[model samples]
Target chain A: EPEVTQTPSHQVTQMGQEVILRCVPISNHLYFYWYRQILGQKVEFLVSFYNNEISEKSEIFDDQFSVERPDGSNFTLKIRSTKLEDSAMYFCASRLQGSEGYTFGSGTRLTVV
Target chain B: QQPVQSPQAVILREGEDAVINCSSSKALYSVHWYRQKHGEAPVFLMILLKGGEQKGHDKISASFNEKKQQSSLYLTASQLSYSGTYFCGTGPSGGSYIPTFGRGTSLIVHP
Candidate 1:
């Protein structure tokens, strides 16, 4: 089965530094999303992208965060100045139009010191 | 808003049956079920839409009740592979379709 792919399975960065996580969503998927799971917590939705623009975003997705579909296949999330609270496993997901399920990538574990 | 899931955790043996329930305070447009092993991404199980629809995938099935704003996931004849945390994500009608998930129901199936 085709799957969403994410790079930098694990990343450690200093607080106040910049980090960019890359993802390649499944081809032909119209909806792409980014979610994060804090240690021992429920998964939280960060943002959703469609048609090259942000469809919706949660409060957690603030000015510090941004997402881009730099290409037809590559989607990226950039955090401009990370904080300790930003440490978590970030997942990238994609869904076909009218599909019930969203295929998720393994995840990118971001750890800010 | 996030849904609430009942039975924080359950222990079962092979072939046993189990039911996990998820409820929301707000009306929902769709309910999605997923299973996640430790330190891994959640795997999609099934989705139940509004209008009181029920969907089944193999021995795992789920039912959604829009009136009650609740959904139930049923596992029949559970297998060892079923040992994981189950999450129910609920999306509100007329929203951006960004579904929020419950804490999760942990299932530990032993031999």
Candidate 2:
């Protein structure tokens, strides 16, 4: 089975610093998404990307958060200024259609201190 | 709005069966199911679209009731490997919509 690859499986950064989480979705998948799971919490949607632009985003994806498909293959989530509350496991997912199930990446465990 | 999952957690022995239910206040076009092991990302289990469809695979199955805005996941003859947190995600329409998930139902199977 094809896997969504995520880099820096675990990342530790100082509070107030910047962080970028990277992901490479399935080659043919058309829709990509970013989600976060706080420790012992429900998974929360961050943003969805399609057709090279953002299709939808949640309130959690505020002014400090931005997503981009820098190239044709790489999808990235950038946090302008990290906060202690920003620590969580960030997962990148992709699917062939809007109504289909998602293939989630292994996730990047972000830790801010 | 976020969906609701019943039996926040369940404990079962191998060969036993279990059921987890998810309900939403708003009508839904599709329902998605996922399972997440501790410290791992959520893995896709299955999806049930409108028309009150039901699907199953490998002793695991799910049902979607679009009119009632509810979905259920059933695990039959469970195995230890079936232990995980199950989540149900719902989409408002068939279009490109962001799916939201419930808090999740934790299942622990023992031998």
- Which number leads on lDDT? 2
> Can you give the TM-score per candidate against the true fold?
0.97, 0.97
TM-score of chain A of each: 0.97, 0.99
Q: For residues B1-111, could you state the per-residue lDDT of candidate 1 as single tens digits?
A: 889999999999999999999999988888999999999999999888765899897799999988999999999999999999999999873465778899999999999
Go through the candidates in order and give the clash count of each: 0, 0
Report, for candidate 1, the interface RMSD. Answer: 1.1
Residue A94 of model 2, lDDT score = 98
TM-score of chain B of each: 0.95, 0.94
| Tens-digit lDDT track of model 2 for B23-107 | 9888888899999999998999998877589999999999988778899999999999999999999877334367789999999
Give the lDDT of residue A70 in candidate 1: 83
Candidate 2 DockQ, CA atoms:
0.82
Query: Model 1 chain A: which ten-residue window has the lowest total lDDT?
Result: A95-104
